[model samples]
Target: MSAALRIGMDIGGSKTAAVALDDAGTVVAATELGTVRGDDGVVDTAESAIVALATQTGVAPSGFASVGIGIPGQVDRGLGVVRNAYNIGVARLPLAQRLSARTGLAVSLDNDVTAAAIGAAHLMRLSGTVAYLNLGTGLSAGFVVDGVPLRGAHGVAGEIGHLAVDPRERPCPCGQRGCLETVASGSALRTYWPAGGDHPGRVLLSAIAAGDAEARAAYDALVAGAASCVRLLVLALDPHTVVIGGGLRLLGAPLVDGIRGELDLAAATSPFLTELELSARVQVLPADSSAAAVGAALAGNL
Candidate 1:
């Protein structure tokens, strides 16, 4: 008999990544494509990913054991619905139902950050509890205990970005002023330095090197806000390890180093913070890690 394989897809604002995992959970096939926007476009993108993976694996779409999607949004996993994912232009989507109907496979949905947390733990071979902070276009977090994800009562356990922390009182989409996201995310970068254009992170470090004062200030805020997030995670969950993931992590070593520096500087002030070893616990998600996609595949098994 053909091995029962699982297919996983991580649908982001700009790209959709998919993978076919063998029974042993190894990714045997993988592909990435530009994500189309809107409700129909989102469904089509996912369907295309599944087809591509099936073709690569020589398995018919319906032959796969299941399909799991990790996407940014307010996800109702039980009903397989997604809402308020503005980046991908999906206001509301019956994602699982539509995809399952089309492919004749059991479909499951997960919050993208949660899926990344699961994938990060498995991929990095970490033990005990783990907290994944996604420094993407927006900030959010995910939690895992041992290998199980904590989705919380309303599935918004890690929406810490919306927490108001800054006295600057910058407006956030969530109708709050001075929210952490307004200070820390990709979107915040645009607001902090409009001259850098829409995708500023691409050129931010270079601009800072060129003595762009605005860029430097913005970068400082991002680093500080992210460090604050790490501190927040420690205070709340005290996870053994905190893995940083998302589009922004692509900034690479500088970003990680800056966050660690911030943590260390704060720890210098208080013995309570020093004993926590916050800097030591922080880790950057590998650039090549297919954590979210792989995590989606694993999530389906649950």
Candidate 2:
């Protein structure tokens, strides 16, 4: 009989993806599926998604050595439980425990962003300190040193979205006021949008391209959020390179240029700051967001 394969599943606020990586780290098979919507459709959706994946690829659950799920929520890695996942309506759910029960296979769970970071570090072929930044419906950062994740004591170390932006601003879902996500995320862009634009990124970018004054102002705010994270990222981790991914990265060159400008302003303060200016040096590849699933699958296996 052939050796069983390792399965990686990346679950985000929007969708879920799975990849089968063999012993060599090469993806042998992969698939993506939408997240369960509405209040009453989660459990079956989650179960069927995997069952479908198994059917699609002929990867029967019993044939796989184990399954890893990378989730975009607070995870109690210790207990393999998802403390809370508002979008998915999961609370204190024993993801790994339950999956293991359902499939009768070893299951591993990890923060989606953490999995992405590990994938990024590996992609860049970096062996030392590395940081992975994910800009999904939410933003998160995770550190991997010598191939291990620093899953902070509270399991929230990478929760940069909740990082405060302005104490006087709007209340965040996390119950805090003026969270960085409030001023910077795709959601924030939608909220702060000036009245006359189509989709948020296009509206913002069109104005930025036209040098529209209001657009430029809003752009500054958005970039500021990223820069603030960048500075914090540098001061704390000093990673050789910070891999930036997520939906926001789709903006491409314009995004890179804007961020480089902010890093420059942040630099005048310290040369070390300038040294980390990765606008041009950093490997900002088209983010293969599926990597998170791969990392998740391999998390405990490694």
TM-score of each: 0.97, 0.86
Q: Residue 236: error of model 1 in Å? A: 0.6
The C-alpha lDDT values of all candidates are 0.92, 0.71
TM-score of 2: 0.86
Model 1 lDDT per residue over 61-155, tens place: 78999888999989999899999999899999999999999988999999999999988998898889999999888999999998899999998
Candidate 1, which ten residues in sequence have the lowest lDDT sum? 1-10
lDDT tens digits, residues 1-302, model 2? 23467778887666778877777776777777787743334444556656766776686756777788888667877788886777776766777777777777787888888887777666566677777766555667888888887888887877878877665487787898888888667766766765424347656777667777766766677777776776677678777777677777776677767777787876778787666664543445464546687778778754
TM-score winner among the candidates?
A: 1
Off by over 4 Å in 1: none
Q: Which TM-score value belongs to model 1? A: 0.97
Q: What is the lDDT of candidate 2?
A: 0.71
- Model 2 off-target regions past 4 Å? 37-43, 165-170, 194-199, 207-215, 275-281
Every candidate's CA RMSD = 1.2, 2.9
